[model samples]
Target: MDAIILQVLNGLDKGGAYALIALGLTLVFGTLGVVNFAHGALFMLGAFCAVTFKKIITLEQIVLSKTELSPWGTPLEIRTPYAQQWFGDFGNVLIEYSVPFSLLLAIPVMLFIGIAMERGIIKHFYKRPHAEQILVTFGLAIVLQEIVKAFFGANPNPQPIPQIFMGAADLGVMVGMAENVITYPKWRLVYLFFSLGVIAAVFAFLRFTTFGLVVRAGMSDRETVSMLGINIDKRFTIMFGIAAVVAGLAGVMYTPILPPDYTLGMDFLVLSFIVVVVGGMGSLPGAVLAGFMLGVVQSLASMTEVKDIIPGIDQIIIYLIAVIILLVRPRGLLGKRGVMEN
Candidate 1:
């Protein structure tokens, strides 16, 4: 029973990431009818944003002291981080929580990148074939990957979780089991809750806000909304930005769990696309639901008993489920009729 609970938690952690990326993919496709193969690159960029913020805050100033000498007779040097000198205790706190703080940097940066990409490149491909769209965006993703490699190298750079969130929590105690029977990382729990909150906020925004109302209408019938003089194009562009932000924030929060490398986005891209397909081509709710569902199944498949029964089951569980879901439900679990029918 404890093992089951642990696996469920693990699934939720993985699902949070899948859901966020898939949600963004669905949003862009649903809103603009554009297949953005480069969406995962935005996730990579968000992780890098955390890396960048940490690097910037920890920038050190070195001073050589003529009067002091080392045991080897070399001049002594004093090195102090600029953030510490500038902001003192507050800077230390910022450095300690750099991953969370990076969200502020990621929001504006990702928003600009998303909008610019849509306006400069994607806009030109609105009427282009899906093949061309996939080709161009995949090429863009490769370019972004190469750029990151050039700047940060090919090695994975791990981000530290906040000091306050470090260590594991004994969840077993909460469920009346023996302590330490179901230990899980505190950060993973934090991430699960954070993902849930973001998902809720997104749903609320779309459900309650006028901007979202217009966007939903545009998604339903673009021509009619345009005929109403609603500037549907502009609204769709903003939705693209919001989608980017969602992906970026997911990346930012994920850095602590997965040390990010230049190829990080590419690694996740295929699986997330699979998630989108299984969820449905453009169904937001389906994306979230399928993400968690697959996550749990994948986690459970990795268990010793399951693995012993079916060798390598964990490796192929998600793909197997995707195939099964596609076979069973052509339009996916919650996909609306007529969507992506063409």
Candidate 2:
């Protein structure tokens, strides 16, 4: 029972990532009708944002110590992070919580990048062939990847979770189980809740706001919405930005779990795309649903009992299910009729 609960929590953690990335992909495709292969790069960029923030705050000042000397050396060097020196306890707190604090930097940066990408490049491909869209966006993704490599190098940079979030929580006690039976990382739990909050916020934005109403209307009938004297194109572009923000924030939060690297985006890109397809090409709810379902299945498949029964089941389970889902539901689990028909 404890094992089952642990795996479920793990599944939810993984699902949070999958849902965020897939949600952004679905948003772009639904609103713009453009296949964006470079969306994963936004996620990579967000992780880098956290990395950059940590680096900036931890910039060190080196000075020769007058009172201390190294063996066979004239003076010992002392180094202190600028943040700690400048802010004292507050700066120390900032450094300790750099990961969450990075959101401030990531949000605006991602928003700008998303808007610029859409306005500068994606808008031109709105009416182009899907193949062309894929090729061009893939090329753009490679370009972004190379640029990141040039700056940050190929090595993965680890980001530390806040001290407060460090260590595992005994969830078993809360659930009326034996003490310490179901321990889970506090950070992972925080991530799960954070992802849920973001997903809910996006849904609320689209369902409750006037802009969301028009966007939903545009998604249904683009020409009619335009004919009604609405600038659907502009709104769609903003939606693209919002999608980028979602992907970026996901990447940012994920840094503590998976170290930031240039290839980080590429690694998750394929899985997320599979998620979008299985969920339904443009269905937001379906994406979230499929993400969590697949995550749980994959987690359960990794168990020793399951792996013993089926060799390497964990690695192939997700792909196998994708194939099965496609075969059974041509338009995906929640895909609307006539979507992607053109």
Candidate 3:
């Protein structure tokens, strides 16, 4: 029972990430009517932001003082692989100092990349067919992934958890468990709560704010909204930007859990699409619910007993459930009656 509960908790954390990514994907598809195959790449870009930030902050030169010991206790001086591989001697300087500090410089730069993608590439595809959009976006995704590889290499680089979150918290006492039991990493807990808060804020924004109202209206009928003197196109662009930021932030925090790599986006992209479909196309609330549910199911499917009963259960459970759901509720749990009627 305790193990089950623990798995449930873990699943919730995974679900949170899926929910965020799927939310963004659904938003773009539901509102813009564009099948954004490059969405996964945007998520990857977000993780890269953290990597970039860490790299930037650690880029300072380490000049050993005449009479002082280095942080390593000796007159320590060594070149980092980054310098040796790329800049030659420059990367060595950064290893001597903090890397996470680079985040201050990495975020805005990433946001600019997001905007540039929207304006330079995605902007022209608004009126194209779904197949064309998907093909082009998929190509764009490949291009982006390759570019990242060109700069950072194809390796899954580790991004260390912040110093403040270096250890696990004792959740046993809080949850009435035995000693030496029920512990979780502080960084993961923080990320879980942070994700929840962001999800709530997004929902609140869409539910209560005028901008959200406009966005929602635009989603339902851009032509009608445009008739009312609102610039739906610009708003759509902003929405795209918002979606990028959401995916990016998801990627950012996720880096500590799963190392950031150019290929990491591919790992989540297919599952995110499944999540969106299971959640019901265009239903944000459904996406959140389905994400967490599938997360649990996927986690449970990994159990020894379950896997023994059904080999490869971990790989098939989510899709199997999705198939059942589709058979039962073709439109999805919370999908509108005529969402795809138009």
Candidate 4:
């Protein structure tokens, strides 16, 4: 029973990330009818944003000290972060929580990148063939990855979680299991709640606000929204920015759990697409539901006994389920008839 609980927790942790990325992908595809292969790059950029902020916060200048000297040197050179010189305790705390603070930095940066991509490149491909869109965007994704590799290198860069949430919480005691029988990372728990809050906020923005109502209406019937003088083109562009922010934020929050490399975006891209397909393209609820469901399925499939029986079931569990779902419901679990049928 305790093992089951642990597996469920792990699944939810992985599922939250899948749902977040898939939600953003569905948004762009559903809203603009453009196939964006570069969405995952935006996610990678978000992780790098955190890295950049950390570098900036810890910028150090060498200073020669008169009183201190090295064994073989005439004078000692001291390195100190500018933040430390400018602000003492607060700066330390800021660096200590840089992962969370990166959210603020990521929002504006992602918005700019998204708008730029939309206006400069994606804008021209709106009415083009999906193949063309995919080719161009995939090229863009590769370019972004190469740029990151050039600057940050191809190796994974680790980001620190806040000291406050570093250790594991004993769920065993809290849930009436044997003492120390179940433990999970506190940061993972924080991440789960944070993801839920972000998802809820996004849905509320789309469902309860006028901007969202207009956007939803546009998604359903763009000609009518435009005919009504809603300027949905501009709104859709903004929605693109929002989608980028969504992906970026997910990447930002994920750095502590998964150290990011240049290829990180490509790694999640296919899996997120699979989630979107299984959830029913353009279906937000379906994406979220499928994400969690697949997560649990994956967790169960990864058990040693199951793997022993099936021999690599864990590796193909998601794809297997996706195949099964698509076979049964061709349009996806909750997909509307007209969506992506062409």
How much does each candidate deviate from the true structure in C-alpha RMSD?
1.4, 1.3, 5.1, 1.7
- Those runs of model 3 whose alpha carbons end farther than 4 Å from true positions after fitting are 64-107
Which pairs clash inside model 2? none
Tens-digit lDDT string for candidate 2 (1-342)? 779879989999899999999999999999998888998899999999999999999999999999999897779989999999989999999899999999989999999999999999888997898999999999999999999999999999999999889999999899798898999999999999999999999999999999999999999999999999999999998999999999999999999999989999998888899899989999999899888888888899999989999999899999998899888886778888778633
The worst-scoring run of ten residues by lDDT in candidate 2 lies at 333-342
lDDT (10s digit) by residue, model 3, range 102-164: 444445655676668778987888888778988988899889899999999989878877666
After superposition, which runs of candidate 4 have C-alpha atoms over 4 Å from their true positions?
Answer: 68-77
Regions of model 1 farther than 4 Å from truth: 65-75
- What number of clashing residue pairs does each candidate have, in the order they appear? 0, 0, 5, 0
Kindly list the per-residue Cα lDDT of model 4 for residues 237-312, writing each as its tens digit: 9999999999999999999999999999998888888898899998989888887778888998898878999999
lDDT of each candidate versus the true structure: 0.91, 0.92, 0.79, 0.90
**Model 3 TM:** 0.87
Give one digit per residue, the lDDT tens place, for model 1 in 217-301: 9999999999999999998998999999999999999999999999999988888888988988899999999888888889999
- Give the candidates in order of TM-score, highest first: 2, 1, 4, 3
**lDDT comparing candidate 3 with the true structure:** 0.79
**TM-score of each candidate?**
0.97, 0.97, 0.87, 0.95
